[model samples]
Target chain A: MAKLTMTVNGRTLSADAEGRTLLSDFLRGGLGLTGTHVGCDTSQCGACVVHVDGQAVKSCSMLAHEAAGSTITTIEGMANADGSLSTLQQAFQDHHGLQCGFCTPGMVMSAAALLAENPKPTEAEVRHHLEGNICRCTGYHNIVKAVLAASGQDVSGVGIAAE
Target chain B: MYAFDFVKPGTLAEASEALSHDGALPLAGGQTLIAAMKQRLNAPEKLVSLTGIPELKGVCAGDGGVTIGAATTHAAVAAQAAAYYPALAALAGQIGDPAVRNRGTIGGSLANNDPAACYPSAVLASGATIVTNTREIAADDFFQGMFTTALHDGEIITSVKFPVPQKAAYAKFQQPASRFALTGVFVAKFADGVRVAVTGASESGVFRWTEAEAALTANFSAAALDGLSVPADGMIGDLHGTPEYRAHLVKVMTKRAVVAAG
Candidate 1:
């Protein structure tokens, strides 16, 4: 076992984890931060997306030991300080970005990362950025709407559900 | 994943020393290695993490070309390599997805040498050099076959140096599910001649389209590739696509790349 420390959300957490412990497993099992869902055991599914050292990555594809000393942000940490929904989360609700919601955490995390980098992405850019995040529900139309709305773009004619 | 001992080496020498041990593998980004481990495809006794080595994590552009550290992530290369090597940057940007791009490194991609990987086409077309702790191998000499390289055991790659070409562009037809190239073509035009590397199509792995290169070297235009066709015998045939389909994509993507470069 390797002893590792890292900043999760805003809190510094340290734990003794096995070398085979995945970041997703570490988050879900070790710390009980189940917000970072692991939908696909294979790295192809983006349900395990999280931010490590400010860059979005698939948590399932990285080991806990590899993420040592890094800062990570999962879906659980995206809420407002006052414990309310963040703008992106609120937008997802307003736009019906999810149905079953298994992929929402990863979707929101991936979109948040995109908006952080490119605040004004086009419709095509938003879709392209979501290539890794697969929604089995096939609710991509609304998800795109939610991301565009979060970016403060005009999503009126972009097939967003009426508020 | 199998039980393995993990060691984060602070320097390249230390990492190399660790790799000299039996059943030791250098871990970069952990994008491919970790996935393979989980699937029971690979099980090494020791994983020497290269992320801690500052010497192997950056991009440097100079007179001849761009030198990218082996540990430099794809996202870093995509964002930083635009000025010196736009084609390289564009290709890097299109690899996998945002999440995969964030952690996947150039060295890992080249070392893995997946038939559909984007980096090999860039390296081959640009005539890059794979620099290792021991010696520098030309791109032509570096890649041997499918998932194979000339890298000796315990010889870790330090960086890759790509000589800037006058005009170059890469175009890929993604396989939707994995986002890997169904067939990708990279075209680089230098003062002397043209180089075209086709990936995701060849059975033997990434190979230069000599016919297309000669055709474009004489006349650097999409129209120059007019009746040229690649045989399907040496191409990959799988559930994703037939060998003939991949061969056809090679020509289509090459034309698209040349047109984009023009």
Candidate 2:
């Protein structure tokens, strides 16, 4: 067993788990942050995406021990300190970016991270960036719109405006 | 996942020593190994985590070449290689998603040597050197076969040395599901010679397409490969594509890569 202490969703938490414990498992099982879902056991699916040390990563493919001392932000932690939806989350909701919603949390987290880095991304940029996050429903058109909208742009008028 | 003892070693020597033990696996980025372990495909008795080894992470440029630490994430490579090795930068950028690229390491990818992986082709085409704890292996001899490498048990890859090429490019047809190369080709022109490496096709893992290389060497033009044919023998056949389709893709991607390289 290994002892892991990390700041998740702005909370400093620690736990002891088997060496094989995945970061996704640690979040859901240990910290009760079930917002990070596991769609596929393989790392191919981005449903388990989260931010570690401010970089987005697939939590399912990461070991909890590997994440020790890191700062992680899950979908549940993306909201404001007062518990309000982030711009991306609101855009996703406004644009109908999700259906069935299994992949929403991961998608939202990834989009949030992308916007954090490149606030104004083109439609192609948004599509390219979100390639890792697969959605079985809502064929990505709305997701792109959501990301564009979240960037505070008018999507309809200017061919998925950037910035 | 099967229960295992995990040891986060702080040095390469310590990690190597731990790997010398029975059923010890060196954990770099854990993007590949950890996922395999979760599926019960791998159950090492001991995992020597290399994350604590500060030395095994970063990109260093010197002596007309760049040395990338084994634990350096793909994102780092993508974001930084643009100024050093543009082809490598583009290839790294095209790997999986932002998350996988952020955590997956070059050492982990090469060590795993998945047939459909993208890095092998780039490494081979660039004629990079694989630096392990024991010795340095040339790219030509490092990849043995599918899911196989020249790494001996307990051998840890410390870093890779890539001589920046005059011009290079990687063109790949990615598997939509996994984002791995369905068929990928990397072409590079070095001071020594032009090297062409193809991945995601051969059953023997990554291998040089000598004919294509010869053609490109003679004339580095897309039209130079107008009638070239990549043999279908000893190629992989899976649901994503057939051997013939892969053979066709090899030529197509190689031509595209050569064009991009020019």
* A-chain TM-score of every model: 0.96, 0.94
**Who wins the lDDT comparison?**
1
- CA RMSD per model (angstroms): 1.2, 2.2
lDDT (10s digit) by residue, model 2, range B68-179: 9998889999987788888998998898888888888999999999998999998999889999988999999999999999999889999999999988999999998788
Error of 1 at B75 (Å): 0.6
Q: Residues B1-262, candidate 1, lDDT per residue (tens digit)?
A: 8999998989999999999998999899888889899888999999899888999988888977999999999999999999889999999999999999988999989889998999999999999999999999999998888999999877788999999999999999999888899999999999999999999999888999999999999999999998899989989999999999999999999999999997
User: Candidate 2, residue A89: CA error in Å?
Assistant: 1.5
Stretches of candidate 1 above 4 Å error? A160-163
| Model 1: DockQ vs. true structure | 0.88
Judging by TM-score against the true structure, name the best candidate: 1
Task: List lDDT for all candidates, in order.
Answer: 0.92, 0.89
Leading candidate by DockQ: 1
Compared with the true structure, what per-residue lDDT tens digits does model 2 show for residues A106-139? 8998898899899999888998888888899888
TM-score of 1: 0.98
